[model samples]
Target: GEEVAQTPKHLVRGEGQKAKLYCAPIKGHSYVFWYQQVLKNEFKFLISFQNENVFDETGMPKERFSAKCLPNSPCSLEIQATKLEDSAVYFCASSQLGPTSIGYTFGSGTRLTVV
Candidate 1:
């Protein structure tokens, strides 16, 4: 089984502050993805990277949210001017053979709380 490593199990930020999350994809995985879960039934895809290049980011917000997955470095997701509504769990995932070939793994996630 594959595994993605996410750091900072929990984050607490004041309103208007910034929050950042870090993720390490599985050793052999080339595709990395970030998802936001604001509600139990909602999983919003934030961004995806194929190696160091961005693959799909249609679900990403035009501003305030950004992500990067670079070669030889941990991937990161950052949110600027955090709002109370931004409080949620951010999950990092990776697939060894792209999203379609299975072998996908999701990290436990970093729970963010905006106060």
Candidate 2:
């Protein structure tokens, strides 16, 4: 498909459990970003990776959130010991990473529920 692909449309976990989401970028995109939408329409940028390296992750919560982007593999975002506040829709986007990168191609997102 031409669009980014995210797996496991909906995931439910108990508080303190682990949550992992996967994202496959478009074939030629080299930069990937992860966003968290906690409220109805509010989104927060979490992290971004360029190819196999971390590009910027300033928005990631220091302790619980970690992400990876590996060559030939789908990118992933994992939360260690998830908290109730971790419940949200996670969106993945991909871009070419250059002047031509005007915007991102976003995935449908994965809804993560923590109870």
Candidate 3:
């Protein structure tokens, strides 16, 4: 079976620092998506990339958040100047659905803690 891979299942960062999380979508999948889940909250879309191009990213935060999908490398999400409120579980998912549709297969997630 195929799976999405995520690193550092748990991360602890101090306020004002940075946190970088990694995710590898299943092979053969053409689209990758990132999501954020704050304590007991619904998963929030962060960004999406189809192949090497960004498909949609309307949900990304304006400050301190950035994401990328590099060739042959796992997609990454970096949060600079982390804040206590940034504590959350970040998830990565992948799909092959065409435009006009939203579908996904999810990873367990990377938990982030800012103190």
- The candidate, 1 or 3, that scores higher on lDDT is 1
Best by lDDT: 2
Estimate the TM-score of every prediction.
0.94, 0.95, 0.92
Model 2 segments beyond 4 Å from truth? none
Q: Scored by CA lDDT, what does every candidate get?
A: 0.91, 0.92, 0.89
Alpha carbon deviation, residue 93, candidate 2 (Å): 0.3
The lDDT, on a scale of 0 to 1, for candidate 2 is 0.92
> In order, what is each prediction's RMSD in angstroms?
1.3, 1.5, 1.6
Candidate 3 lDDT, 1-115, residue by residue in tens: 3999999799999999999999998888889989899957688988999988888989988688999998899999999999998999999999878533565788999999999
Candidate 2 lDDT tens digits, 11-115? 999999999999999999888999999998799999988898998899999798999998889999999999999999999999986423876899999999999
Return whichever of 2 and 3 wins on TM-score: 2
lDDT, candidate 1, at 5: 90
Error of 3 at 5 (Å): 0.4
- Weakest lDDT window of 10 consecutive positions for candidate 1: 96-105
Model 3 / residue 65 / CA error / Å: 0.4
Off by over 4 Å in 3: 99-103
